[model samples]
Target: MIAAKRILRKAQRQLACRKRKIAIEEIMESKGDPTTFYKLVRQQRSSTSMGTEFLTLNGKTAESIEEVTQTWAQYFQQLATPTAESTYDDLHLGKIQDDINLINQICNSSHQDDIPTITKDEIHTAIYKLNNSKAADIFGITAEHFKLAGPSLITALHCVYNRFIKNQKIPESIKRGILTPIYKKGAPDNPGNYRGITVTPVILKTFEHIIRQRHQIILEETQSRLQTGFTKGTSPLVSARPTYRVHNRI
Candidate 1:
């Protein structure tokens, strides 16, 4: 019995060594690709605290992987679907009403003819601005696909964009995105503890970049100087500077 236990322990040690070697090789191979490298690192960890397993909802326990997935889908769907009882009666009004009116007036008075049409050059520029190593949308399309596409594809996109602009309508496909639930905190089994991150199509993002680029001047002029969050080349830490000074004075 003692001899048998010794042999089993030796076998387990050998298996662990093999796994360690394999993991090292994979990490080395993925060194150049930051996305894959981080993913591999995550896999090497013993366990994750964020439980994606929908063990139970209400009183019913999920029996299979499919059931768990379905439960998550239903939970997110219900959250997205607005209640029939919902109304704008709970909202409050102040000077915001005047601001809304001003925006509406500007939009109504804007001339469609004065707006410049989408061009191939603009499409190329937008495509170039896309970031690398992002999650694909529902269609399995990534930013890399657009970045590597030739001039012919750029011309095609240019035409499609202009057509949408001329008709004042966007295709339904462009608006679709895939939502991934990321665990935040609290009970892992509870869907309420997770927030969603939507993966939008690269093409749709490129089009948005084009629109933003066209209105860059206006946005820069109208944007508040004190705002730091989400603004390019500005850090959220900048907003903390004033708070830090106030704390020191106090």
Candidate 2:
């Protein structure tokens, strides 16, 4: 259930980013000026957040991911006005509906068999692999980077992801509710901090290679703050300090 939420939230960001990028390109094609670009940035927040899931940043915000998603969907429905006359020709409308149908089958279903299983990590590994293996040059940014999960998966997901973003960035509205795993910051013996990790290309490629050959993606267990700062004095019962990563590959 938790993994499902991550998949949903990440999906929103990924989809919204693509839409935003395309919109920017359309605006640029008209030679829109600096003012237009500034306006674009200002409105970018709404575009990204609207009809999309968001991790609540503060306490006052509602904690329910489902409520937030429903709110977004309602906003989109209200905003997407129907036209009496078809703006899209029959052929175009058909294609659009087809695409929507395909995505719906893949993403929107309660039955496991009905919906194709596409995991966030699997998607990340696919995009990262593609990027390293020539797709990045073609697309500029890898899909994982485009999706903005690389940093979180590597360093912060184990900790920085508050209860909100960790498992429920994307809430599954139709299927069910969201569940957050207990955030583990390590024990008293292994308290620590993670200096931001600079992911090496080799490691990134390793992820791609693993996925390519094994048909599975493995996110290496990252050393987080919990592992580093643990002190024996904090826990008198332990004979040794808790295991922690001082540096690479602990």
Candidate 3:
């Protein structure tokens, strides 16, 4: 399986250092009581993502168990949907809104969706109102001047925000699947419009030596080395769900 193979490679990288010697006593200790041997097997699987939590008296070594389980769990956790509140920033929001306005106009939504067929005058008025709280000053006909659009603005806003939210999730998956893979394959003859793939070091190195090689701080590899100590084989050792949140008023 792809998951199993990925696990084996990772485990091989990590355990490369710990392959000194194992006495018969230690090997026998692993086999003595079926219960004890079983515990070690579970322990081996417990630290990885492969779902090998409990098993029969299995193979000579349990290399792939931990890595596969850990990787799969990580994949799912990254699959989590981000909340709208913490997901977008002011620049992103503004660009989204701008694009949406243009889209609505193109779709004839402004006319068909019952939104006032906004002229240059109305747009100017709204811009002034948006710029300052003096909405009444902008709109000459001002009783209790509060701008209201029909279905078009509402639909456009919702759709644009939805897309912006999706965009945040896109880069990572692209890096993991498409972008990183292309980078690893090397600079194409026509590297047209390729948003640089610096996501994975192994992939990124094909382009340039951006970060240090053979550093002790390789997060995934280091985490794998310390995985058994950090987790109950549930999730990766996370710091915290990103502490940064946009403070801008929507």
Number of the top candidate by lDDT? 1
Candidate 1, poorest ten consecutive residues by summed lDDT:
45-54
The TM-score values for the models, in the order shown, are 0.66, 0.21, 0.18
**Candidate 1 RMSD to the real structure:** 8.5
lDDT of 3: 0.35
CA lDDT, candidate 1, residue 250: 100
Shift of residue 57 alpha carbon in model 3, Å:
28
Q: Scored by CA lDDT, what does every candidate get?
A: 0.74, 0.40, 0.35
What residue runs in model 3 are displaced by over 4 Å at the alpha carbon? 1-11, 15-80, 84-88, 104-250
Which numbered prediction scores highest in TM-score against the true structure?
1
Per-residue alpha-carbon lDDT of candidate 3 for residues 28-77, written as tens digits (9 for 90 to 100): 46665655643433333232412222112222232355753344344344
**7-57: candidate 1 lDDT, tens digit per residue:** 986676456545545665676688799789646554543244222434467
Candidate 1's C-alpha runs over 4 A off are 1-51, 58-60, 84-89, 92-111, 224-229, 235-250
Please identify model 2 stretches exceeding 4 Å from their true place.
Answer: 1-84, 109-250
Task: Please tell me which model should have the higher TM-score, number 2 or number 3.
Answer: 2
